[model samples]
Target: MTLEGALIRSEGLSIRHGGREVLRDVSFAIEAGEIVTVVGPNGSGKSTLLKALIGALPPAAGRVTRRAGLRLGYVPQGLRLDPSMPMTVGRFLNLPKRVAEEGRTRALAEAGAQGLEDRPLTALSGGQFQRVLLARALLDRPELLILDEPTTGLDQPGQAAFYQRLEDVRNSLGCAVLMVSHELHVVMSASDRVLCVNGHICCEGRPEVVAQAEEYRALFGTGTGGALALYRHEHSHRHDETCELDHTHGEDT
Candidate 1:
Protein backbone atom coordinates (compact mmCIF):
# COMPACT_ATOMS: atom_id res chain seq x y z
CA MET A 1 0.00 0.00 0.00
CA THR A 2 1.95 3.00 -1.24
CA LEU A 3 1.01 6.53 -0.19
CA GLU A 4 3.00 8.35 -2.85
CA GLY A 5 0.56 11.20 -3.11
CA ALA A 6 -0.69 13.18 -0.14
CA LEU A 7 -1.61 10.78 2.61
CA ILE A 8 -2.96 13.45 4.92
CA ARG A 9 -4.40 16.85 4.01
CA SER A 10 -6.02 19.54 6.10
CA GLU A 11 -7.69 22.54 4.55
CA GLY A 12 -9.18 25.45 6.48
CA LEU A 13 -9.20 23.31 9.61
CA SER A 14 -10.24 24.94 12.85
CA ILE A 15 -10.87 23.75 16.38
CA ARG A 16 -12.49 25.47 19.34
CA HIS A 17 -12.25 24.25 22.91
CA GLY A 18 -14.16 25.89 25.74
CA GLY A 19 -15.00 28.79 23.41
CA ARG A 20 -11.31 29.35 22.66
CA GLU A 21 -10.13 28.93 19.09
CA VAL A 22 -7.01 26.83 19.42
CA LEU A 23 -6.43 26.30 15.71
CA ARG A 24 -7.66 28.28 12.73
CA ASP A 25 -7.53 27.73 9.01
CA VAL A 26 -4.46 25.51 9.24
CA SER A 27 -3.59 23.77 6.00
CA PHE A 28 -0.87 21.21 5.31
CA ALA A 29 -0.15 17.92 3.54
CA ILE A 30 1.99 14.93 4.47
CA GLU A 31 3.22 12.51 1.86
CA ALA A 32 4.60 8.97 1.83
CA GLY A 33 8.21 8.31 2.80
CA GLU A 34 8.39 11.82 4.14
CA ILE A 35 8.88 12.94 7.72
CA VAL A 36 6.97 16.14 8.51
CA THR A 37 7.47 17.64 11.94
CA VAL A 38 5.08 20.05 13.67
CA VAL A 39 7.00 22.48 15.87
CA GLY A 40 5.88 25.20 18.27
CA PRO A 41 5.91 26.26 21.91
CA ASN A 42 3.53 24.77 24.46
CA GLY A 43 -0.19 25.64 24.15
CA SER A 44 0.52 26.49 20.52
CA GLY A 45 -1.97 23.90 19.18
CA LYS A 46 0.64 21.38 18.14
CA SER A 47 -0.97 18.56 20.11
CA THR A 48 -4.43 19.70 19.01
CA LEU A 49 -3.43 19.14 15.39
CA LEU A 50 -2.20 15.64 16.19
CA LYS A 51 -5.47 14.72 17.90
CA ALA A 52 -7.41 16.03 14.93
CA LEU A 53 -5.26 14.00 12.55
CA ILE A 54 -5.75 10.80 14.53
CA GLY A 55 -9.54 11.23 14.70
CA ALA A 56 -9.53 11.74 18.43
CA LEU A 57 -11.03 15.17 17.93
CA PRO A 58 -13.27 16.27 15.11
CA PRO A 59 -12.44 19.55 13.43
CA ALA A 60 -14.91 22.25 14.37
CA ALA A 61 -14.54 23.41 10.75
CA GLY A 62 -12.82 22.38 7.49
CA ARG A 63 -11.61 19.05 6.12
CA VAL A 64 -9.00 16.41 6.96
CA THR A 65 -8.35 13.81 4.30
CA ARG A 66 -6.60 10.59 5.20
CA ARG A 67 -5.76 8.22 2.41
CA ALA A 68 -7.85 5.08 2.27
CA GLY A 69 -6.41 1.84 3.71
CA LEU A 70 -3.58 3.73 5.38
CA ARG A 71 -2.80 2.28 8.81
CA LEU A 72 -1.88 4.78 11.52
CA GLY A 73 0.31 4.10 14.55
CA TYR A 74 0.06 6.77 17.20
CA VAL A 75 1.97 7.46 20.42
CA PRO A 76 0.08 10.06 22.32
CA GLN A 77 1.50 12.94 24.43
CA GLY A 78 1.75 10.79 27.55
CA LEU A 79 1.36 7.12 28.47
CA ARG A 80 -0.88 6.96 31.53
CA LEU A 81 0.57 3.98 33.37
CA ASP A 82 -1.76 2.30 35.81
CA PRO A 83 -0.13 0.76 38.87
CA SER A 84 -3.13 -1.53 39.30
CA MET A 85 -2.87 -2.98 35.82
CA PRO A 86 -0.42 -5.76 36.58
CA MET A 87 0.61 -6.31 33.00
CA THR A 88 4.22 -7.07 32.19
CA VAL A 89 6.03 -5.31 29.35
CA GLY A 90 5.51 -8.34 27.16
CA ARG A 91 1.82 -8.44 27.95
CA PHE A 92 1.49 -4.74 27.18
CA LEU A 93 3.01 -5.34 23.77
CA ASN A 94 0.44 -8.00 23.00
CA LEU A 95 -2.35 -6.15 24.74
CA PRO A 96 -5.96 -7.18 24.00
CA LYS A 97 -4.60 -10.21 22.15
CA ARG A 98 -3.01 -13.60 22.73
CA VAL A 99 0.73 -13.13 22.25
CA ALA A 100 2.49 -15.08 19.59
CA GLU A 101 5.85 -16.02 21.01
CA GLU A 102 7.99 -14.82 18.10
CA GLY A 103 6.06 -11.60 17.58
CA ARG A 104 6.39 -10.65 21.24
CA THR A 105 10.16 -11.10 21.30
CA ARG A 106 10.73 -9.21 18.05
CA ALA A 107 8.72 -6.18 19.13
CA LEU A 108 10.49 -5.88 22.46
CA ALA A 109 13.93 -6.14 20.89
CA GLU A 110 13.14 -3.57 18.25
CA ALA A 111 11.95 -1.13 20.91
CA GLY A 112 15.08 -1.78 23.01
CA ALA A 113 12.82 -3.14 25.71
CA GLN A 114 14.10 -6.73 25.64
CA GLY A 115 15.42 -6.89 29.17
CA LEU A 116 12.24 -5.23 30.44
CA GLU A 117 9.97 -7.95 29.09
CA ASP A 118 8.92 -9.32 32.49
CA ARG A 119 8.69 -6.01 34.33
CA PRO A 120 5.33 -4.45 35.03
CA LEU A 121 4.49 -1.37 32.99
CA THR A 122 3.98 0.64 36.16
CA ALA A 123 7.39 -0.36 37.47
CA LEU A 124 9.15 1.22 34.52
CA SER A 125 10.43 4.78 34.74
CA GLY A 126 9.38 7.52 32.39
CA GLY A 127 11.90 6.65 29.69
CA GLN A 128 11.17 2.95 29.93
CA PHE A 129 7.46 3.58 29.56
CA GLN A 130 8.11 5.73 26.51
CA ARG A 131 10.02 2.89 24.86
CA VAL A 132 7.27 0.46 25.80
CA LEU A 133 4.70 2.61 24.06
CA LEU A 134 6.99 2.91 21.07
CA ALA A 135 7.17 -0.87 21.02
CA ARG A 136 3.40 -1.03 20.89
CA ALA A 137 3.34 1.45 18.00
CA LEU A 138 5.56 -0.88 15.98
CA LEU A 139 3.45 -4.00 16.47
CA ASP A 140 0.98 -3.29 13.66
CA ARG A 141 3.70 -2.13 11.27
CA PRO A 142 1.74 0.96 10.34
CA GLU A 143 1.99 2.83 7.08
CA LEU A 144 2.34 6.13 8.94
CA LEU A 145 3.57 6.82 12.48
CA ILE A 146 2.24 9.79 14.46
CA LEU A 147 4.25 10.64 17.56
CA ASP A 148 3.27 13.49 19.86
CA GLU A 149 6.19 14.80 21.91
CA PRO A 150 8.02 11.46 21.73
CA THR A 151 10.94 12.56 23.83
CA THR A 152 9.10 14.09 26.75
CA GLY A 153 10.41 13.00 30.18
CA LEU A 154 13.46 11.37 28.65
CA ASP A 155 17.04 12.24 29.50
CA GLN A 156 19.22 13.72 26.77
CA PRO A 157 20.88 10.47 25.71
CA GLY A 158 17.61 8.56 25.80
CA GLN A 159 16.01 11.26 23.65
CA ALA A 160 18.81 11.04 21.09
CA ALA A 161 18.66 7.24 21.07
CA PHE A 162 14.88 7.29 20.73
CA TYR A 163 15.14 9.34 17.54
CA GLN A 164 17.83 7.06 16.25
CA ARG A 165 15.50 4.14 16.88
CA LEU A 166 12.70 5.97 15.08
CA GLU A 167 14.96 6.51 12.10
CA ASP A 168 15.72 2.83 12.09
CA VAL A 169 12.03 1.90 12.27
CA ARG A 170 11.22 4.31 9.44
CA ASN A 171 13.87 2.69 7.29
CA SER A 172 12.86 -0.84 8.21
CA LEU A 173 9.14 -0.33 7.74
CA GLY A 174 9.44 2.19 4.88
CA CYS A 175 6.68 4.25 6.49
CA ALA A 176 6.27 7.98 6.73
CA VAL A 177 6.41 9.78 10.09
CA LEU A 178 4.54 12.81 11.39
CA MET A 179 5.94 13.96 14.71
CA VAL A 180 5.18 16.88 17.05
CA SER A 181 8.34 18.04 18.73
CA HIS A 182 10.05 21.09 20.28
CA GLU A 183 13.58 19.67 20.09
CA LEU A 184 14.45 21.46 16.88
CA HIS A 185 18.14 20.62 16.73
CA VAL A 186 17.37 16.89 17.01
CA VAL A 187 14.59 16.66 14.43
CA MET A 188 15.92 19.29 11.96
CA SER A 189 18.34 16.90 10.33
CA ALA A 190 15.96 13.93 10.37
CA SER A 191 12.89 15.70 9.01
CA ASP A 192 12.08 15.89 5.30
CA ARG A 193 9.88 18.96 5.87
CA VAL A 194 9.00 21.16 8.84
CA LEU A 195 5.61 22.59 9.74
CA CYS A 196 5.78 25.46 12.22
CA VAL A 197 2.44 25.85 13.95
CA ASN A 198 1.31 28.58 16.26
CA GLY A 199 -2.50 28.78 16.12
CA HIS A 200 -1.83 28.28 12.40
CA ILE A 201 1.20 27.47 10.32
CA CYS A 202 3.54 30.38 10.79
CA CYS A 203 5.70 28.84 8.08
CA GLU A 204 6.55 25.55 6.39
CA GLY A 205 9.69 24.79 4.43
CA ARG A 206 12.98 22.94 4.49
CA PRO A 207 14.55 22.82 7.94
CA GLU A 208 17.38 25.28 7.26
CA VAL A 209 15.13 27.78 5.50
CA VAL A 210 12.43 27.55 8.14
CA ALA A 211 15.05 27.99 10.85
CA GLN A 212 15.78 31.47 9.53
CA ALA A 213 12.22 32.73 9.41
CA GLU A 214 10.90 35.22 11.96
CA GLU A 215 8.14 32.79 12.82
CA TYR A 216 10.78 30.22 13.63
CA ARG A 217 12.46 32.69 15.97
CA ALA A 218 9.17 33.10 17.75
CA LEU A 219 8.60 29.36 17.71
CA PHE A 220 12.06 27.98 18.59
CA GLY A 221 13.54 31.02 20.35
CA THR A 222 16.75 29.97 18.57
CA GLY A 223 16.98 32.47 15.73
CA THR A 224 17.07 34.97 18.58
CA GLY A 225 19.78 37.24 17.01
CA GLY A 226 21.82 34.28 15.71
CA ALA A 227 21.41 35.44 12.12
CA LEU A 228 22.71 38.86 13.07
CA ALA A 229 25.70 37.30 14.76
CA LEU A 230 26.44 35.31 11.63
CA TYR A 231 26.23 38.45 9.50
CA ARG A 232 28.48 40.38 11.87
CA HIS A 233 31.13 37.68 11.67
CA GLU A 234 31.00 37.68 7.87
CA HIS A 235 31.32 41.47 7.76
CA SER A 236 34.27 41.39 10.15
CA HIS A 237 36.04 38.73 8.09
CA ARG A 238 35.75 40.71 4.82
CA HIS A 239 36.95 43.88 6.49
CA ASP A 240 40.01 42.14 7.92
CA GLU A 241 40.84 40.53 4.56
CA THR A 242 40.69 43.88 2.74
CA CYS A 243 42.95 45.52 5.33
CA GLU A 244 45.54 42.74 5.06
CA LEU A 245 45.62 42.97 1.22
CA ASP A 246 46.03 46.78 1.29
CA HIS A 247 48.82 46.61 3.89
CA THR A 248 50.71 43.98 1.84
CA HIS A 249 50.55 46.09 -1.38
CA GLY A 250 51.65 49.25 0.47
CA GLU A 251 54.74 47.48 1.89
CA ASP A 252 55.69 46.18 -1.60
CA THR A 253 55.36 49.66 -3.19
Candidate 2:
Protein backbone atom coordinates (compact mmCIF):
# COMPACT_ATOMS: atom_id res chain seq x y z
CA MET A 1 0.00 0.00 0.00
CA THR A 2 1.16 3.53 -0.71
CA LEU A 3 2.17 5.48 2.38
CA GLU A 4 3.44 8.97 3.09
CA GLY A 5 6.61 7.80 4.78
CA ALA A 6 9.54 5.99 3.20
CA LEU A 7 8.94 2.51 4.62
CA ILE A 8 9.27 0.24 7.65
CA ARG A 9 11.70 -2.28 6.29
CA SER A 10 13.28 -5.43 7.67
CA GLU A 11 16.13 -6.48 5.49
CA GLY A 12 17.13 -10.12 5.94
CA LEU A 13 16.05 -10.36 9.56
CA SER A 14 16.97 -13.41 11.60
CA ILE A 15 16.65 -14.55 15.20
CA ARG A 16 18.15 -17.18 17.45
CA HIS A 17 16.96 -18.35 20.85
CA GLY A 18 19.10 -20.52 23.12
CA GLY A 19 21.36 -21.19 20.17
CA ARG A 20 18.47 -22.52 18.11
CA GLU A 21 17.87 -20.78 14.81
CA VAL A 22 14.20 -19.79 14.90
CA LEU A 23 13.94 -17.27 12.07
CA ARG A 24 16.27 -17.00 9.10
CA ASP A 25 16.54 -14.47 6.29
CA VAL A 26 13.19 -12.87 7.06
CA SER A 27 12.40 -9.56 5.40
CA PHE A 28 9.38 -7.44 4.48
CA ALA A 29 8.13 -3.87 4.32
CA ILE A 30 5.07 -2.09 5.67
CA GLU A 31 3.85 1.41 5.04
CA ALA A 32 1.71 3.97 6.77
CA GLY A 33 -2.02 3.11 6.97
CA GLU A 34 -1.21 -0.38 5.78
CA ILE A 35 -2.33 -3.58 7.49
CA VAL A 36 0.12 -6.47 7.16
CA THR A 37 -0.55 -9.94 8.56
CA VAL A 38 2.20 -12.55 9.22
CA VAL A 39 0.80 -16.06 9.10
CA GLY A 40 2.28 -19.55 9.50
CA PRO A 41 1.90 -22.77 11.47
CA ASN A 42 2.64 -22.92 15.19
CA GLY A 43 6.37 -22.62 16.08
CA SER A 44 6.99 -21.08 12.67
CA GLY A 45 8.27 -17.87 14.32
CA LYS A 46 5.34 -15.59 13.52
CA SER A 47 5.34 -14.03 16.97
CA THR A 48 9.14 -13.94 16.99
CA LEU A 49 9.05 -11.80 13.87
CA LEU A 50 6.54 -9.42 15.45
CA LYS A 51 8.60 -9.19 18.61
CA ALA A 52 11.66 -8.32 16.56
CA LEU A 53 9.78 -5.60 14.71
CA ILE A 54 8.89 -3.94 18.02
CA GLY A 55 12.38 -4.36 19.54
CA ALA A 56 11.24 -6.77 22.21
CA LEU A 57 13.59 -9.35 20.76
CA PRO A 58 16.70 -8.29 18.94
CA PRO A 59 17.37 -10.08 15.70
CA ALA A 60 20.38 -12.31 15.84
CA ALA A 61 20.93 -11.43 12.18
CA GLY A 62 19.78 -8.71 9.80
CA ARG A 63 18.21 -5.43 10.91
CA VAL A 64 14.88 -3.55 11.12
CA THR A 65 14.83 -0.01 9.89
CA ARG A 66 11.97 2.44 10.08
CA ARG A 67 11.23 6.12 9.69
CA ALA A 68 12.38 8.56 12.36
CA GLY A 69 10.07 9.50 15.24
CA LEU A 70 7.78 6.57 14.48
CA ARG A 71 5.72 6.18 17.62
CA LEU A 72 4.66 2.59 18.19
CA GLY A 73 1.76 1.11 20.15
CA TYR A 74 1.90 -2.58 20.95
CA VAL A 75 -0.86 -5.02 21.97
CA PRO A 76 0.72 -8.27 23.02
CA GLN A 77 -0.80 -11.74 22.81
CA GLY A 78 -2.48 -11.35 26.20
CA LEU A 79 -2.59 -8.95 29.12
CA ARG A 80 -1.09 -10.27 32.33
CA LEU A 81 -3.07 -8.21 34.84
CA ASP A 82 -2.45 -9.32 38.37
CA PRO A 83 -5.59 -10.11 40.33
CA SER A 84 -4.28 -8.12 43.29
CA MET A 85 -3.62 -4.94 41.32
CA PRO A 86 -6.18 -2.47 42.62
CA MET A 87 -6.82 -0.47 39.48
CA THR A 88 -9.89 0.50 37.51
CA VAL A 89 -9.86 0.44 33.78
CA GLY A 90 -9.66 4.23 33.61
CA ARG A 91 -6.85 4.53 36.12
CA PHE A 92 -5.00 1.64 34.55
CA LEU A 93 -5.02 3.32 31.19
CA ASN A 94 -3.13 6.28 32.64
CA LEU A 95 -0.41 4.29 34.36
CA PRO A 96 3.15 5.66 33.85
CA LYS A 97 1.69 8.24 31.48
CA ARG A 98 -0.79 11.10 31.72
CA VAL A 99 -3.82 11.33 29.47
CA ALA A 100 -6.74 13.71 29.57
CA GLU A 101 -10.06 12.35 30.82
CA GLU A 102 -11.68 13.11 27.49
CA GLY A 103 -8.90 11.38 25.60
CA ARG A 104 -9.13 8.27 27.74
CA THR A 105 -12.89 8.19 27.44
CA ARG A 106 -12.75 8.67 23.71
CA ALA A 107 -10.21 5.92 23.23
CA LEU A 108 -12.13 3.52 25.43
CA ALA A 109 -15.34 4.38 23.65
CA GLU A 110 -13.73 3.75 20.30
CA ALA A 111 -12.46 0.39 21.56
CA GLY A 112 -15.91 -0.45 23.01
CA ALA A 113 -14.60 -0.41 26.60
CA GLN A 114 -16.63 2.55 27.83
CA GLY A 115 -18.64 0.72 30.47
CA LEU A 116 -15.47 -0.89 31.77
CA GLU A 117 -14.16 2.42 33.12
CA ASP A 118 -14.99 1.61 36.74
CA ARG A 119 -14.59 -2.14 36.42
CA PRO A 120 -11.62 -3.93 37.90
CA LEU A 121 -9.06 -5.05 35.33
CA THR A 122 -9.44 -8.65 36.48
CA ALA A 123 -13.20 -8.60 36.01
CA LEU A 124 -13.08 -8.25 32.25
CA SER A 125 -13.39 -11.14 29.82
CA GLY A 126 -10.88 -11.94 27.08
CA GLY A 127 -12.60 -9.72 24.52
CA GLN A 128 -13.04 -6.89 27.03
CA PHE A 129 -9.41 -7.09 28.09
CA GLN A 130 -8.28 -6.95 24.47
CA ARG A 131 -10.40 -3.86 23.84
CA VAL A 132 -8.96 -2.11 26.88
CA LEU A 133 -5.45 -2.95 25.73
CA LEU A 134 -6.22 -1.50 22.33
CA ALA A 135 -7.51 1.64 24.02
CA ARG A 136 -4.34 1.91 26.06
CA ALA A 137 -2.30 1.60 22.89
CA LEU A 138 -4.31 4.41 21.30
CA LEU A 139 -3.61 6.78 24.15
CA ASP A 140 -0.23 7.66 22.65
CA ARG A 141 -1.82 8.36 19.27
CA PRO A 142 1.04 6.37 17.81
CA GLU A 143 1.87 6.41 14.12
CA LEU A 144 1.99 2.62 14.06
CA LEU A 145 0.11 -0.09 15.96
CA ILE A 146 1.37 -3.66 16.41
CA LEU A 147 -0.95 -6.42 17.53
CA ASP A 148 -0.07 -10.05 18.30
CA GLU A 149 -2.98 -12.42 17.88
CA PRO A 150 -5.31 -9.57 18.83
CA THR A 151 -8.45 -11.64 18.19
CA THR A 152 -7.59 -14.59 20.36
CA GLY A 153 -10.39 -15.91 22.62
CA LEU A 154 -13.08 -13.79 20.96
CA ASP A 155 -16.30 -15.08 19.51
CA GLN A 156 -17.24 -14.40 15.90
CA PRO A 157 -19.25 -11.33 16.83
CA GLY A 158 -16.53 -9.97 19.10
CA GLN A 159 -13.88 -10.47 16.45
CA ALA A 160 -15.97 -8.61 13.84
CA ALA A 161 -16.69 -5.76 16.23
CA PHE A 162 -13.05 -5.45 17.22
CA TYR A 163 -11.95 -5.22 13.60
CA GLN A 164 -14.61 -2.58 12.89
CA ARG A 165 -13.41 -0.52 15.82
CA LEU A 166 -9.80 -0.83 14.69
CA GLU A 167 -10.74 0.25 11.17
CA ASP A 168 -12.52 3.32 12.48
CA VAL A 169 -9.53 4.27 14.56
CA ARG A 170 -7.13 3.70 11.67
CA ASN A 171 -9.26 5.78 9.29
CA SER A 172 -9.33 8.69 11.67
CA LEU A 173 -5.69 8.47 12.73
CA GLY A 174 -4.17 7.33 9.42
CA CYS A 175 -1.77 5.08 11.33
CA ALA A 176 -0.16 1.92 10.00
CA VAL A 177 -0.99 -1.51 11.43
CA LEU A 178 1.03 -4.71 11.78
CA MET A 179 -0.90 -7.58 13.29
CA VAL A 180 -0.03 -11.26 13.96
CA SER A 181 -3.04 -13.51 13.72
CA HIS A 182 -4.13 -17.16 13.42
CA GLU A 183 -7.63 -16.45 12.11
CA LEU A 184 -6.66 -17.20 8.51
CA HIS A 185 -9.91 -16.20 6.83
CA VAL A 186 -10.26 -13.00 8.82
CA VAL A 187 -6.63 -11.98 8.39
CA MET A 188 -6.56 -12.74 4.68
CA SER A 189 -9.74 -10.74 4.21
CA ALA A 190 -8.61 -7.69 6.21
CA SER A 191 -4.89 -7.28 5.57
CA ASP A 192 -3.51 -5.13 2.76
CA ARG A 193 -0.64 -7.55 2.28
CA VAL A 194 0.16 -10.98 3.64
CA LEU A 195 3.61 -12.28 4.72
CA CYS A 196 3.69 -16.02 5.12
CA VAL A 197 6.50 -17.05 7.49
CA ASN A 198 7.70 -20.51 8.34
CA GLY A 199 11.11 -20.07 9.95
CA HIS A 200 11.45 -17.65 7.02
CA ILE A 201 9.24 -15.94 4.48
CA CYS A 202 7.60 -18.53 2.26
CA CYS A 203 5.92 -15.79 0.24
CA GLU A 204 4.92 -12.13 0.41
CA GLY A 205 2.26 -10.43 -1.71
CA ARG A 206 -1.39 -9.46 -1.74
CA PRO A 207 -3.56 -11.91 0.19
CA GLU A 208 -4.91 -13.63 -2.92
CA VAL A 209 -1.50 -13.68 -4.56
CA VAL A 210 0.37 -15.15 -1.61
CA ALA A 211 -2.45 -17.57 -0.89
CA GLN A 212 -2.00 -19.05 -4.36
CA ALA A 213 1.77 -19.33 -4.15
CA GLU A 214 3.33 -22.77 -4.30
CA GLU A 215 5.40 -21.93 -1.25
CA TYR A 216 2.21 -21.06 0.59
CA ARG A 217 0.85 -24.50 -0.25
CA ALA A 218 4.05 -26.19 0.98
CA LEU A 219 4.05 -24.15 4.13
CA PHE A 220 0.37 -23.80 5.18
CA GLY A 221 -0.62 -26.98 3.37
CA THR A 222 -4.19 -27.87 2.32
CA GLY A 223 -6.09 -26.26 5.16
CA THR A 224 -5.66 -22.75 3.73
CA GLY A 225 -8.39 -22.85 1.05
CA GLY A 226 -6.13 -24.73 -1.39
CA ALA A 227 -5.27 -28.30 -2.22
CA LEU A 228 -4.80 -30.50 0.83
CA ALA A 229 -1.55 -31.90 -0.45
CA LEU A 230 1.20 -32.31 2.12
CA TYR A 231 4.86 -33.20 2.14
CA ARG A 232 3.79 -36.77 2.68
CA HIS A 233 0.64 -38.69 3.52
CA GLU A 234 0.65 -41.43 6.13
CA HIS A 235 -0.86 -44.80 5.27
CA SER A 236 -0.63 -48.50 6.15
CA HIS A 237 -0.84 -50.13 2.74
CA ARG A 238 1.76 -51.50 0.30
CA HIS A 239 1.06 -52.96 -3.16
CA ASP A 240 4.30 -53.73 -5.01
CA GLU A 241 5.21 -55.99 -7.92
CA THR A 242 7.97 -57.49 -5.80
CA CYS A 243 5.43 -59.08 -3.48
CA GLU A 244 3.41 -60.41 -6.45
CA LEU A 245 6.53 -61.87 -8.03
CA ASP A 246 7.52 -63.62 -4.84
CA HIS A 247 4.00 -65.06 -4.48
CA THR A 248 4.08 -66.39 -8.08
CA HIS A 249 7.45 -68.09 -7.56
CA GLY A 250 6.20 -69.70 -4.36
CA GLU A 251 3.09 -70.89 -6.16
CA ASP A 252 5.16 -72.36 -9.07
CA THR A 253 3.74 -69.93 -11.61
lDDT on C-alpha atoms for all candidate structures:
0.72, 0.72
Q: Which ranges of candidate 2 are over 4 A from the true structure?
A: 1-4, 208-253
Model 1 C-alpha RMSD to native? 12.5
How close is each model in CA RMSD to the real structure?
12.5, 11.5
Query: What lDDT does model 2 reach?
Result: 0.72
TM-score of 2: 0.77
Model 1 weakest 10-residue run by lDDT: 227-236
Clashing pairs for model 1 are none
